[model samples]
Target: FTNPDSTLLTKAGHHKLCHYIALTDAFPLPIDKEEVSWKCLVKGAHRNEEMINKLEALEANSTLKSRVIDYVWGAGSQLRGELIYKARVAVPSAYSLPGSVTEEELRKALNWLIQRMQLTHPDINAKVCWPVLYSFAQLTSLKACTCSEDKPWQHPIFPHLIKTQWWGRKGEAKKLGNKEDSNPFINTPITLMALVATAVRPFLVGLNIF
Candidate 1:
């Protein structure tokens, strides 16, 4: 999200998605792009501010391919004191795919999966929201959304995925899935947090709904 002067975009008062996307140097090549064929383009394909900074670093450096965000409970905390109920997170080289992988090979292998899902769930044939793609070092996106259109006949695939995460309330996470705990936190827990991405939902919810 660096600006033209390399200042972070969030510094500005107003910015559109296009503005941030411009920073990433990404272009559209969706699963359904018809003219060129999705298969030809994506032979294989594949989060946070500190996370974002980390990925950008990896993408910049050709020598490195991945990094790790260790198990912790402190990300949401002001002091980041807690360390219970956690999942290890990997910071992949999102823009850069790793060695020993090729797009043609991944497309051929995943073709069966794509076809099978379409055949098995004909309902999704229109929606086209299955087969979430997390791919090689090179096969990654800076940002994407994957929520469906919900209305039929519209493009079913929206881009809403990046990593695999497990979320739990603080108490349940404290318990770490133990059955005996008398109290399990019930609300949506901050299993993951980003300086970007999740801000607008709460903003709109407060402005319109509440």
Candidate 2:
């Protein structure tokens, strides 16, 4: 058993343990050309090539058809007419491993994990909604599609709403005498307004008053 917190395990020990687990559990090896080349030089390139080709054939035969989206929603909203956006999301660091793999393979694996979460978790699905709105708004703003008209959420009506919300929050932050709380939005009106507009659009669409 590997103990992640154990002081006895040096960095190299932890890495070797991870490598053993990856190999034994048949996880995708981390892309490590140097390590692969070294192994090939020691064990003979033909033998290594034969093993890799067999693994590739097996992977091709068993590849799943499902796909996953690469992004997540950053939930932003208004509270009591005050603009608020969620804290920045933190992505966990990728596990360190050594093996040969392409960028596409890594992307596919990550997306697969996301798809699994979306299938099994309702909370994650709800959190994803705002980011989807953000992405849509960005694409529409950039005129990435053939649709020529502006989205209802992108109209001028919402910026006023956002500005009002922001000033209200600024007042509240001042009353609380907290420098940290007040400073976050002090010079961030434009950025905060954009996030607020993105957050508000979905609800507006649902209300069907457009």
TM-score of each: 0.17, 0.21
Residue 83, model 2: lDDT of: 32
Tens-digit lDDT track of model 2 for 1-210: 133321221222233322222222212234542343223222322345543444344235433101000000000112312332221110111111113434434343334323332211111211111112554374322211111133423433343444454335554323434365544434443444444444443332332222
Model 1 alpha-carbon drift over 4 Å, by segment: 1-98, 113-172, 175-177, 180-210
Q: In candidate 2, where is summed lDDT lowest over 10 consecutive residues?
A: 65-74
Colliding pairs, model 2: 30-99, 31-99, 32-99, 73-131
Error of 1 at 14 (Å): 26
Candidate 1 global Cα RMSD: 22.4
